[model samples]
Each structure stands twice: as C-alpha cells, then as structure tokens.
Target: MEDTEVREVTTSAAKTNDPDGRRMQLLNYGIQTSIKKCLSAVRYARIEKVLSPIAQSSPEILKQIHKQMECQLQTNIMDEISSMFEEENISGLMNNLDKIIEETSLGPDEQAWRPSGDPSLDVLPHVYSTKLKERSSLEKILKEVEDKNRQLHEALRPRQQRLETLKKDVLKECQYWEEAAGAIPEDYKQKMEKFIRT
Candidate 1:
C-alpha cells in the first residue's frame, strides 16, 4: 500500500512539472523569437532609411519613419504577447497599441504609451538593450568625428583671419592708387615686382 501511494505521488509530481517546464520553455522561445523578429525589422528599416533617396534627402521624413518604426515594433511585439493572454485582454491591449502607433506616427504631441508598467512585458526591454549598445558605439564614432571637425576648424581660423586682413589692406591700397590718378604707388609696385620674382 505504501509503495503504491509513493509511486502515485511521484507520477503526479512528474505530470505537473512537465506541463510547467514545457510552458516555461515555450514562453522563453516566444520571447526570443519576438526579439529576433523585432531586431530584424529594425535592421531592414535602417537599411531602407539609408538607401532610400527620399529618406536621405529629408530629415523630417527620416525622423517620422524612425518614430513610426519604433512604435510599430513595440506594438507588434505586444500584439504577439497578447496572444498568450485572455481574448478580451488581447483586444484591449491591441487597441492601446494601435492608438500608440497612430499617435507616435502623427507626432510627439500625442500622449505617449509605455510598457514599463506591465510586468509580463519585462523581456521587451532586452530589445532596446541591443539598440543602446549600438547607440553607444555610434556616439563614440560621432564624438571622434566632431572632435576632428573642431580641430580642423580651430587650425584654419588664424589662417583665415590673416588672409582676410591682408585682402582688406590690399583693397585699400588699390583704392588709394586708383584715386591718385591711376598710377600704381611706387611702394606697392616694388612689392608686386618682388612677389612676381619669388
């Protein structure tokens, strides 16, 4: 009798654990798949944004595309996750996501929607973590480019100022010579002759 009860208990425990373990595995797989899809979409959007002449030419359109893509990805991922929840909850969540996409696509004036308050969506932050790494790398490159630009600008400033001063002096001297009966000034003529010989 004791052996039979122990076997039954063991079997029941295995049955319960199996379903939970499978559920967790499925959940993990779902999250990973969603992140991969989102990242792939982002990559495509970036490529399109870079390669398209319209996006390259107009900054406003690029910004709008960026905003729309961001909202679209978030909404897409949420909609996927909503499938795991109740039917009623799914519709409400989807409606909220649609509203958010519309608002984001329209402009910044609309009320922003966030997933931070939802505990079940914690995995979504990982998607942005990858973006943050890329952003940091890009920021480093941008800083280097900006520093080089500043150095180039600084190096050129004194030369530019000197050239401007020399040009003004030359113009004034030319005007004086012109007013003085069109004959080249003796001192200026000697400088021009020396410059030509050099």
Candidate 2:
C-alpha cells in the first residue's frame, strides 16, 4: 500500500508539472479506450441484431467476441478511432462515442435506442480505465474507419435482399391480376360496352 501511494504521488507530481502534456496524453488514451469499447459493443450489438439472419447466432459467441475485444484489441482499436476523430476535429469523449457511433451506423433498435445517446449494452466492461498514448501510426490509425465501413455494408445487404424480394412479389401480384381480368365474363363486357350509349 505504501509503495502504491508513493508511485501515485510521483505520477501526480509529474502530471502536475506538465498539465497540458498530461491532458493530451490522457485524452489520447481515453479516446482509444472509448473507441475500442464502442466498436466491441457495436460488433456484439450487431451480432445480437442480426443473429436470426446469420448462420451462427449464439449469445455465448457474442459474449466471447466481446470478451476477446476487451482482452486484446479494444485498447488498440479505440486509439485508432480517437486519433481519427481528433483529426476530423470530432470531440474525443468516450462516454458518448460508443452510442454516437452505434447510432450513426446501426440507426436504432427498439429495446436499446436511447435518445440521450447512451448505448444499450451496459453489461460490458468499463472503458477509460487507464491513461492514453500521445501519438500513433497513421496505418494503425485508419483501421477502425475501415472496420466501420465494412460493418455498414454488411448491415445493408440483408435489407437490400428483402427489398428485392418485395419488388418481385409485387410484380407477380400485378401479373396475376392482369391474367384474371382477361378472363372476365362476356356478359360483363357487353354491359360495359352498352354503357357507352350505343
């Protein structure tokens, strides 16, 4: 406990000596953590959203995926999204990033959408549990953007298929009606013609 206290004090003093530097480092770390969590939640939420449609719809797999994200890639992914967001001059707050990105890409779900911008998955681990890096590679930076792009296209594919099926059904219905109308009674046609005031 004494050693922990001493280390914290030293860290505090170093941070106090260069507050701006500390803040920037902190901000970068925060963004990375937040984005990672956001993406993981987004991915899991996607699994949950699309389970019935996809081949493997196990909540266990979803949990495993989320756990893997937190254990391995979450920090790295968040860093990338944060760096990009900062470059775009988007605010780097993590609390809202998850929900904002979720809403931006997935639109909304009935049980989970929050008008205040909070995400639906509260069971996931807390983000922003540590400090941040001040800089990172551009190659490393754009990974999240690409991942997000892929996610959007995937989500749209099923909806597009449904639309195509609907169009085919409607066209078929029209054809059926046309064929039925062609077989109309001769008497009805004669009556319709007489209404022309022959």
Candidate 3:
C-alpha cells in the first residue's frame, strides 16, 4: 500500500491520541515528502546543467546570446545619438563623420569602388547654408522612403531572383514522403514508425 494508506491504518490502530505518537507520525510524513521533493529537484537541476551548453550552441535555438548582444549594443549607441539628426546639429555630425571616413580606390577585383556622377555636371546644391529648411511633411517622408525602397529593390533584384531559382532547385531534389497511413504496408507499419516527418 502507498504511504497515505499505511499512515491511515497506523492511526486507526491507535484508537486514542497520544500527542507524542501523533507528532511523530506528522514528522515522519514531512521528512518523507521533503526527501522525495529534494531528490526530484536535484534531478531537474542536473539535467538542465547538462543541456544548457548544448542548447546555447545549437543553431535551431534562434535569438541566441551572441546575436542579441550585438543588436543591443547597436541599439544603445543609436539611442545615445538622439539629437544628432537635427538640422542645426547635422552640420556638426558631417565633421565628425568626415573624420571617420577613409578614402580609398578599389581595384577591379576588390569590388568596392563606385564613383559619384559627372564632374562636368557642375555646381552641387549646398546643404546647411544657415537657411533652415522646414521639417519634412509626412507625405514627403513617405515619398523619400518609397524612393529609397525602390533603389534597394533595384540593387537586390538579381540576388532575389537567384534565391528563388535556388529554392526551386532544392525543392525539386528533396524527396517528399507520403504521409498517409493507408499507403503503408500493414506488415511494415506494425514494425516500423507509423509516421515519417518531412
């Protein structure tokens, strides 16, 4: 019989309560429960310690520590520069940004060189001429964003097309298993796994 049933019978046999006997019974039950709980808790802690490193290293466990750390570091730096995008402060940023710039010419194989426009096109429009331009309207902001998106799409077009072609080729090669149990032979089904996960 289980512990509770044994304890019930023990109490029934002792028709009268000797305070000492009742106290001892309660103490025994408490000690037994505590021991069992401690053993179970220890098992869980040991298992977690064993699995923690494996889980951390696994690619399937996305948003892992390394990626989150980089994201948080970048977010913090940008947050600290809250006022730098302002019209008056924008000129100040150009000097600091310019200092960080390293000018270099890329050879054909190096692939990084892209020159800006025709020198014969003449005068460039000056920004920060101390004449304040009004803050952009919501419509203008949306239009600028759309135009930038169009440029990004132009740059990504070939890569995106290649990705789609690659996906199709991979899918063509990958064998798709039939999921229906009805399609499986009864002899095999009894001995083998009933389902095969694709």
Candidate 4:
C-alpha cells in the first residue's frame, strides 16, 4: 500500500507539470502578440490613408492653398492695424503725403532749392538741428491736441448719456401714447377726428 501511494503521487505530479500545457500557454502568448502587432499595423494604415491625399496633391494646388492662407493672414493683420488706427484716432489725424506735396507744389523742380551737390559735412549739423526743432514743435502741438480731445470727450460723456436717456424716455412715452390711442373707442376716435377737423 505504501508503494502504490508513492507511485500515485509521482504520477499526479508529472501530469501537473506536462510539457504540452506549457506549449499551449506559449502558443496563446504568441497569438496575443501577433494580434497586437496587427492592430498597430491597422492604425498605421489609417494614418497613412489620411496623409496620402495631401502627399499626392499637385504642387500648384499646394501653392494656391499656401497663397490663400497667406492672403487671409495679411487681411487679418490689415484689419487689426485699421482698428488700432481708428481707436487711436490716428486715421483722422493722418496727413496724405501726396496731397500735401501737391498743395505745396513740391516736385522735381523744387529739388533746385536743395544744395546743388551733396551737402557739405558742415551744413549737415545745421540741417539736422532745424529738423529736430520742427519735430519738437510738431510733437508739442500733437500733445496739446490730444489733451484737448480727452477733455472734450470727458465733457461730452454726461451729455451723451443724458441724450440716450432722453431718447429712451421719449420712446417709452411714444409707445404709451400709441397704446392709449389704440385703446380708445371707435366712436370717441371719430368724435376727436371731427373736433380736430373743425
């Protein structure tokens, strides 16, 4: 009986440690790894599908797209600059150089007023000094104008608000009168019309 029991235990241990079971586990692991690889490949194929159209596009088409994007960017930049100019009230203050030139009668003929040749080094300092004086005077005038504009805006703010309020009140009154008029009896309206005609 001891020998039979020992043989049964050894046989059971051998069955539990079978090489076929290990082989099957290895085969399942290989299959799972291959499935993961296939899924990754499919994802890569999808990415390639999205990129292929752009890659295959003609050069002219690509250039057109680039130009359109560039144009839109330029337009947006111009709009921003225009808004800044307007907000700063600089657009209204800007002098048209061409118009000023025409009004001043400055042309190629006016070049004669300049030195016949390149100005001497000695004259350059005087010219620069004169230009600096003019620029300073212009800047002072601009500062004064800006100050006046700010003061005027401050002064008008209350008046503008009052006007807006008055307008709203007038509208309300008008609406109330319209409703009152609509509610009048037809006979009363006719009587009032007759009285007005008289």
Top-scoring candidate (TM-score): 4
- How accurate locally is residue 66 in candidate 1, as Cα lDDT from 0 to 100? 72
Clashes (N, CA, C under 3 Å) per candidate? 0, 4, 0, 0
Candidates sorted by lDDT, best first: 1, 4, 2, 3
Task: Give lDDT tens digits, candidate 1, residues 1-198.
Answer: 645654555466467764323233344445655676766666646755576887668767676777787777777876767576555554355556656666668465766556677775866666788979999999999999999999999999999999999999999998897888457678998898999999
Q: Which residue pairs overlap in candidate 3's backbone?
A: none
* Order of candidate numbers by TM-score, starting with the best: 4, 1, 2, 3
Tens-digit per-residue lDDT, 95-185, candidate 3:
4454445335455588753445754432233443322343446567889999999999999999999999999887766634444656788
Best by lDDT: 1
- What TM-score does candidate 1 get on C-alpha atoms? 0.32
Which portions of model 3 miss their true places by more than 4 Å?
1-144, 174-176, 179-186, 194-198
Local accuracy of candidate 4 as per-residue lDDT tens digits, 115-149 = 64766865886799898999999999999999999
* lDDT values, one for every candidate: 0.69, 0.63, 0.56, 0.64
Q: How accurate is candidate 1 locally (lDDT)?
A: 0.69
**Could you tell me which residue pairs clash in candidate 2?**
29-132, 32-78, 32-79, 36-78
Estimate, for each residue in 85-109, the C-alpha lDDT of model 2 and write its tens digit.
Answer: 6787554354356456656775346
User: How well does each candidate superpose onto the true structure, as a TM-score?
Assistant: 0.32, 0.26, 0.20, 0.38
Winner of 2 and 3 under TM-score: 2
| Span of 10 residues, lowest total lDDT, candidate 1 | 19-28
Model 4: worst 10 consecutive residues (lDDT sum) = 19-28
